[model samples]
Target: MLEDQANDPAIVDQVLEKSGLSRDDLTSATYSAQKEALFVRFACDVLADATFAARAGLQFKSSSSLTAYISKYSRDLKQVLENASRFHGLIDPALMFSLRVAGNFAAIEAEWKDASYARYHRRTEFLLFAGLARLRDLTQSNFFPIEIRFQHEVGSSRNKYQRLAGFPVLFGAERVEIVLALSSLDLPVPTYDPKLREHLLEYGDRVIAEKRQPKQKLRAQVEGLITRSLPGAIIQSEDAAANLGLSARTFARRLKEEGTSYREIVEDLRCDLAQTFITNGMPLSEIAFSLGYADQPAFSTAFKRWTGQAPSAFRSRLDVSAKA
Candidate 1:
């Protein structure tokens, strides 16, 4: 999309050559985030066009695959945004879009989980424009937001942004946000489908779960193994290494290179899983056993270390919040 909108369309070809990347790499079904970011960076450097990313993004009338289908079947704009926020990790784990209602206004805030990625002007520009385009497409309306906020400065291109957005565009704000009237969230999607929307949401949840499993990352692989083994005996480093077809020494070395250790991985995983189990109303003893701890007291000590509170205390807090 960026390529098509480049000032000199041939610049994209030059960028591909300069970056040692073939068009096939981008068009591949398995195009990864790193590859996409590389292409964007190369294009941005070569083109030096600030508005092209936003222009290209504004042209994105539809979303990708399941996300698009899910949006198409959602009952209203509110449901569409909710589903988008819920299933966002499946599309791009680095960026998160959240919808919040405050008084008479609704704000769709875009937060970058990977802080480094947030610094990329091209990527951030594309995110905002693409989101606005998708929302307009879903509602079949050109209704504008009350205002748009961006964290990056476009310098002399600021006026062009306002003209393009058909609304006020504030730069160097706290974050990327699209502010709209609260009632606009209920704007019905023209193709709303209750039944298909339900089914698509279910499938989106499964996809999110599948994405959480191990992929190519060593850390993710180790975490996946740890999670699966949590209900039984603790998985030792040597055992995990063998399972991954690596020697214990090599496993420890690789994990260290990834900025973590096997012991840290297990501790972190258990800390997270402990809170989840406690929230689900699991008995303290059962939660301890599920996390492979020998006894509840040991688990409680570790939990306090991890979260600065006992499991019972955390559960009580959750219960109080729920009641309130």
Candidate 2:
């Protein structure tokens, strides 16, 4: 939700050192950037109890949106890391640093959604295995001890514990935790702002608490409407309100109380859809039409205003590269 540049080199260094890898292993790939950035953030936060960088890192330079970064790098990072265990023999500290960084990034997608406890657990497991594998490769020690705490009972997959995480897996615990060696925590990574970290934690707590309540139903309804109606269908406030069985005025008041507006929701939806359409190589005219635009010219004008490039030109560049 927070869109900022990523500039956390300490996090990068910490992951690499922890995994015993370095930067030379990543010279040929650009797709791993996002995963690398996020891995650094997550690893740093876990180890240092703060964000990877005190501020946004260098990866945030070209894109102001975190979602954009994720969209671009998620797959590439995964691909690069598919064969990570093969690099276990490298002894250079710097190379170890890079491998750790890559490993952290590779494990990120698994742990991305804290909202879903199951998803969070699954990701944590994957991250533990990946981290341990890297450690094993570096130290030549296959028997690493890892302690995992889960929010609910571990699911009934007999091999779930053994097949995924090679270490000890504990479930139905009071809190979620992954215990590795104390030395793993020794990687020198700076903490982000304490106040900001506290704020974020508090925010996460509130979100988790809210998810446990019945009021989340309303939020779900709102999200459903936003997802259902967007660029092509400019859903009017009154119309959307009517669909929800509320009077237009009442719906507007409720949205205001919730700290959002119908227009803002529409704009956000448009922005999300526009990015998807652009990435998928949809013609601007078609995209505009699909989004309920009047004509190609109108869509072209709006696309330029949104992204600083005409839709056709953007598509053309993509096409040229594809041919090349």
Candidate 3:
């Protein structure tokens, strides 16, 4: 959006290069100080409009891969929010979304996990308007939020935001969030598909598992290899290190420097997948096989050691909690 709105689109690339980021880094899960600096410089230095962030935000359609997945798979606003909360790290690692219900209002609270990035009010406003734009597109509703809250003071841009939002835009609030009537969450998305939603959700989770790993980190690379090789022969440590073109001793030393080992990584990865499979109601034997365990007994023993409960007992408790 900034590129299109710029007087010279080339300037956007120039700014990105100046900030020490590449075009490819824009969609990656890793957060970069250089990327954040680019936004600050663009809005404050180049555009020189206090409301440029909000303006650019509202004009943004759901063109990113993550937003396209949400548009196609989500059943309604509630599902949209759920997917956003779960997989948002794939696109924006610095912020998180959570749904909050208070009396008659349902709020989509935007919390900044990176305080340095959050301090830029323009970036926050851009995210706010961009989110509103996407929700409006998905829900096929022109309705504005009941009110908007900002943690920052309402400078001279209050009126500009009010004009854009067509509703109350409050400033200096407890947190940054978009508030709506509780019933709004039930609005159906035109593209909802139950089966496709399930498939895409699993895909999203896998993408997240891969993307959330630091790009060049040894541990992350090992985890990715393990994940891809699952349900077949589990790749042994020496083979994994060989795949990465590292000698076994060098691999062990590097992993130890990173405060982990290949065995520990395998254990941790299986524990995570075990819980996810249990939650999804996969059969115990299937979960065991998927995690590359030789048999149900071995998987069950490992699971009990990890969670201090039998697989059957864990599934039963999950069912009970769901019923509750």
The candidate that wins on lDDT is 1
Count the clashes in each prediction. 0, 26, 0
Selected candidate, larger TM-score, 2 vs 3:
3
lDDT for each candidate structure:
0.76, 0.44, 0.75
lDDT, candidate 1, 1-324, per-residue tens:
655555576877787766567778767656666456556655654444456667777888965678889989998888888888887767775578899899999999987654435435566777788888998999998778899898654544578788877789897588689898987898989998889988988888888877753345687777767754646587889999999999989999999999999999888878756764564356888778877888989999999999999888997876665465
Q: Per-prediction TM-score, please?
A: 0.63, 0.34, 0.59
Worst lDDT 10-window in candidate 1: 112-121
The most accurate candidate by TM-score is 1
| lDDT for each residue of candidate 2 in 98-206, tens digit (9 for 90 to 100) | 2232332212111211121122222333433444443333333344454544432333332445444555656545544444443442322122234543454454445
Worst 10 residues of 3 by lDDT: 40-49
Candidate 3 residue spans exceeding 4 A from truth: 1-6, 10-14, 21-37, 208-324
lDDT of 1: 0.76
TM for candidate 3 is 0.59
Q: How many Å off is the CA of 201 in candidate 1?
A: 1.2
